[model samples]
Target chain A: SQTIHQWPATLVQPVGSPLSLECTVEGTSNPNLYWYRQAAGRGLQLLFYSVGIGQISSEVPQNLSASRPQDRQFILSSKKLLLSDSGFYLCAWGGTSGIYEQYFGPGTRLTVT
Target chain B: AQSVTQLDSHVSVSEGTPVLLRCNYSSSYSPSLFWYVQHPNKGLQLLLKYTSAATLVKGINGFEAEFKKSETSFHLTKPSAHMSDAAEYFCVVSDRGGGGADGLTFGKGTHLIIQP
Candidate 1:
């Protein structure tokens, strides 16, 4: 069975502070990883996706960035946090095959005060 | 471009009653549709998906959805609603050819309220 993990589960950051969220998948290799943010009214917005190591695609321009350091490890980072950057961030992984199904992690909640 | 619309922002249903969460999608070609549930402050968990193989797809937690191509709707249903079913539901659409690298478009989400 495949499982995804993300942390820190929750965080409180001051405005203009740095942000880092990590995601990893076990029992799978070369998985496609994605980052999504869910806000009150914005819904789930795709922030970044990775097809392989060192390859990241930005879906929307924002304060965040993503990196795939290893085949199963993905990181979402920001140099400075904004009030608008606070939301529930999710990490997902999908197989490298044709079907487009995705599995999500527990998520991280960042509260920028 | 692909998009999804969850018809109701909130739905209230009594326990043991039928559950209906409406969703419609727009895609230029054949699309892959999915239904995901989010518990408060948690990640989205997929309930079911339609990938062109089955018109009626059965998913986890006793939930099922029927794909209507003519209407471009994938509505989720359950025979009986449970208190545990109270959560936010999202409808998603994906381009059939892009795989997961293209990402998914999510609906605004419907807040399902289970009445006692």
Candidate 2:
């Protein structure tokens, strides 16, 4: 019964503009959250993950950053966006226990022009 | 370090034909493997996962995968291919004992094309 919500479903941003994408989960608490990006015709790339509030781990250095402001709320932000920052961003959550299966949100498609 | 390799970038099959997508993985320890599907413009959906409990795992939409430890491969199969099955498939691997903090490593993906 757990579900994740991400928005805005699609966005068009100008280069060098600020960016913010939000993801929230329901029916679970203290779950681990992750941020991933998929470029056109490329595989999913891990950007950041958080085990708890105020804790974030970066996998690959890029123009994006992630934050877990609440137990079930994760936000991906950038002070200034780059053309390379445009991609399909996904949010996922996994249980705190030994359960390793991750549930994904609908995702946000950003187009930086 | 754990990594996954999808042997094929594109696979075409006729409707009702058997479907197979090949995957291979490398891990230092016992690893957890998964297959995920992504529809165009949609998020990735987990189809199946292998955690060392069973070599053969069944997933949604009549899809199944077998884990061959000796070969270090987990290949996904289906009895019949459907038009709805046309999408991109990704093979993923994760370390089993590292507190599960390490995010999944994904394959480049295989594009499954269902021919009419």
Candidate 3:
């Protein structure tokens, strides 16, 4: 069975602070990875997706960036966080065979004050 | 371009009553559709998906959705609503082209409220 892990589960940060969120998947290799953000009572917004190591496609231009350092490891980073960056971040993985069904990680809730 | 529209923003139903959440979609080609549920403070969980093979797709937790191509709609339904079923539901659509790299377009979501 495939599983995704994300941390730190929840975080509270002051404005203009650096941010880093990590996601790792087990039981699968070469899977596509994605990063999504959801505001309270809002739909999920795609931020970035990676097809392979060092390959990332960003959907929205914002204060966040994503990196695929390894085959199953994806990291979301921000040099400086904005108040608008407060939201729930999700990591997802899908098979390389063009499957649209994605498996999501536990997610991280970030609160910027 | 592909998009999804959830017809209802909020739906309230008494426990044990039938549940229905309507969704409409637009796509240039044959599209893949999905339903996902998100409980408060949790990640999204895929409920069901339609890939053109079967019009009626059954998912976890006794949830099912029918794909109507003529209507361009895929509506989720359940025989009985449970208290645990109260959550936010999102309707999603993905393009079949570009090797699935187009990602998914999500609807605003429908909040399902289970009344006791």
Q: What is the C-alpha RMSD of each candidate to the true structure, in Å?
A: 1.3, 1.0, 1.0
By DockQ, the better pick of 1 and 2 is 1
As a whole number from 0 to 100, the lDDT of residue A16 in candidate 2 is 97
Candidate 3 at B116: error in angstroms? 0.3
| Highest-scoring model, DockQ | 1
The clash numbers for all candidates, in the given order, read 0, 0, 0
Error of 3 at A16 (Å): 1.2
User: Per-residue lDDT tens digits of candidate 3, residues B20-67?
Assistant: 999999988788899999998888899999998989999999999999
Chain B TM-score for all candidates, comma-separated? 0.95, 0.96, 0.96
- The global C-alpha lDDT for each of the candidates, from Candidate 1 onward, is 0.90, 0.92, 0.92
lDDT of 1 by residue, B1-116 (tens): 78888999999999999999999999877888899999998888999988889899999999999999989999999999999999999998888564347657788999999999
Off by more than 4 A, model 1? B98-100
Lowest summed lDDT window (length 10), candidate 3 chain B: B95-104
Please give the distance, in angstroms, between residue A6's alpha carbon in candidate 1 and its true position after superposition. 0.3
Interface CA RMSD of each prediction in angstroms: 1.3, 1.2, 1.3
lDDT of 2 at B60: 98
Indicate the TM-score of model 1. 0.96
Worst 10 residues of 3 chain A by lDDT: A94-103
- Writing each residue's lDDT as its tens digit, candidate 1 over A1-112 gives 9999999999999999999999999998799899988876568888899989999999899889999989999999999999999999999998467657789999999999
**Please, what are the lDDT tens digits per residue for candidate 3 over residues A2-110?**
8899999999999999999999999988999999999886888899999899999999999899999899999999999999999999999985676788889989999
> lDDT, candidate 2, residue A15?
97
